[model samples]
Target: MLLGCLPGLAAVLALALCAGGVERSVAASGRQVVARPAAAHKAVRPHIVPRSVWLDDDTRHAQPPPRYDDRVIAVFVHHTDSPNGYDCADAPRIIRYLYAGQTGSRDWDDIGYNFLVDRCGTIYEGRAGGIDRPVTGAHTQGFNHRTTGIAALGTFTAGVPVPKEMTDAIAALAAWKLGLSGTDPRARVRLTSSNSHSRYAAGASTTFPALAGHKDGYMTSCPGAALSALLPGIRETAARLQGRH
Candidate 1:
């Protein structure tokens, strides 16, 4: 009877050992799942909208987009140099200043650009979305009525030039706009010294047409020299964002 009980006890000890060993092997093989702490499980980041949305979010005090004369034949670029490039993050504030001056001083009621691109490539909403529509702006000569203005915060005339990221944003926006306007996204959009109808023929298979600096129907340095040199590239990138080949 003692021997029989001994065998039974051994069998029970072996089963316990096997079960324990299997658990240890699972832990050692890195297959054991660790339950997160209760507090940790609740910590997750939320999605965020852009700062441009904040500019347009005025409860009942908001302005509306214009209903007339928005042909948007071209896009112009500018730099906010008077206040300096270091304040790129405060571009919306500058927009407010411009809108005040354009309205109060120059007799227009809002910021000039349809869009403003900051040094860090952040795009902000501008005048085209405002109420009491502006038919005139100081963005370009002979074409402010027909052109869509897009300003970048940096003075890239002689500096190291506009960053490629900025060019990318400009291109993407331009491309998307082209798609909406029923224009060929891959066309060359340049205001030449010889033409006024916007050239959409001289582009690579991947790039969209964009009006280059000094090409608009205006006489001023619209996008300047350095940054202007990158318009073709910008247009191409913008086209791709619209899912064109």
Candidate 2:
């Protein structure tokens, strides 16, 4: 009897280990069932360098408390329109320069973009808000609310080679951020225009790609033709990263 009981005990231990340490219980039918762990629906957040890496106390501007929305349903992609030949080592310096220009010349309270990606595929936290929150950015004039802005570090005009690393980083960032709200990157989201300056008049309801170029909501040829052409692929990649079939 002891030897038979030892075999049964070994089998029960194996089942527990295979079930990932979850508890097992008997079902109404009298069959033992293993309770598996719940599946994770959210994507893993990608690595992002904090604003302090680039902005120190001396350069930090005095801005109002970061504004937030209910959730981030869309993302706007943009190009800095700056030089593309910058070394990755100088990315922090370049970001600082852009911050100064936006705050000094443009008179903006802080950097407009919620995040920035360099040519070397490094992601940097922009603005003065928490990256995980749906911070209202100033990148898109009419659709700033309920959206996040990601600016590619350099210019990407027609015929220019958009770095693969940069695009991959953007996709990863989008997958995680949009995944927070269970948003599909390939889906079209309806956004109400807050400013009349956009392509759509103020208060107009329009549908745009969840992952869109800055030009989609605005009149400017922002993000340039080269990067604009890559939006579709980026959307698909982001969806895949989020485990969408």
Candidate 3:
């Protein structure tokens, strides 16, 4: 009984020491000294998108079953494929229109993208699930699971100048989202294709940039040429935000 109690006491002592870095110091007089406070690790939280900023209270819909993945490892950038000349003040309305179109006309359960960014760099929350959760989206057909979709709120065909602010916000958002799982934005990750509509057959494993373009997974020229061209820089900026050299 004494030996059994000794082992349990030792285990508790070890746990307590590890919890807060318990230290032992000796003074010149041979008396035990107290430990100094340990420094805290740096926290890197960027702007977290609020759902209220984009989701109107009246955008009523029936609740669909939620889908989620283990974690997010990739980000796919896209363009809304709508006109680019609208005033920034009308962004919410435009987003609502897009949401309605996708849900009502296209019959999707909800807006596909995980997030949306305007030309002015304002980030808006998309989808009906929690932003921090790995909510499986319907944006990129085969690569929806374990990934995030950020749609730039405009048509960005070739020669259409992609806004700097938009890309910057995208980088910040990507950094925060990827950093949550300690994923390197500039790295390549292999994901199994869930749909054959993608470049690879269903269940084929493929390697792609952690920050990928919509076209990388599917044949459609989504995200458009201008925005796609900006993805490399976005990836680099996101990595830097995550403190990657």
Estimated TM-score for each candidate: 0.57, 0.83, 0.80
| Model 2 pairs in collision | none
**Model 3 C-alpha lDDT per residue in residues 1-245, reported as the tens digit of each score:** 00000112223211110002345666889887868644332126556566576667687556687799988888888777767787988888877776665666456677777888988998888886787789988778778889988888777778999989999999988888877666788888889998686788889998989898888887667777888888989988898877776
What is the C-alpha lDDT profile of model 1 across 29-123, one tens digit per residue? Answer: 68876553222101111121233553434412233445344433345565443323456557666555544444443444345556667666667
TM-score: the better of candidates 1 and 3: 3
The candidate maximizing lDDT is 2
Weakest ten-residue segment in model 2 by summed lDDT: 1-10
lDDT-better candidate, 1 vs 2 = 2
Lowest-lDDT window of 10 residues in candidate 1? Answer: 13-22
Better of 1 and 2 by TM-score: 2
In model 2, state the lDDT of residue 33.
80
Give stretches of model 3 more than 4 Å off: 1-43
Residue 78 CA displacement from its true place in model 2, Å: 0.3
Candidate 2 C-alpha RMSD relative to the actual structure:
18.9
**Model 2 over residues 77-154: C-alpha lDDT tens digits?**
988777788899899888787777667655678888899999999999998789889998888878888888898877
**Global lDDT of model 2:** 0.80
Overall lDDT per candidate, in order of appearance: 0.45, 0.80, 0.74
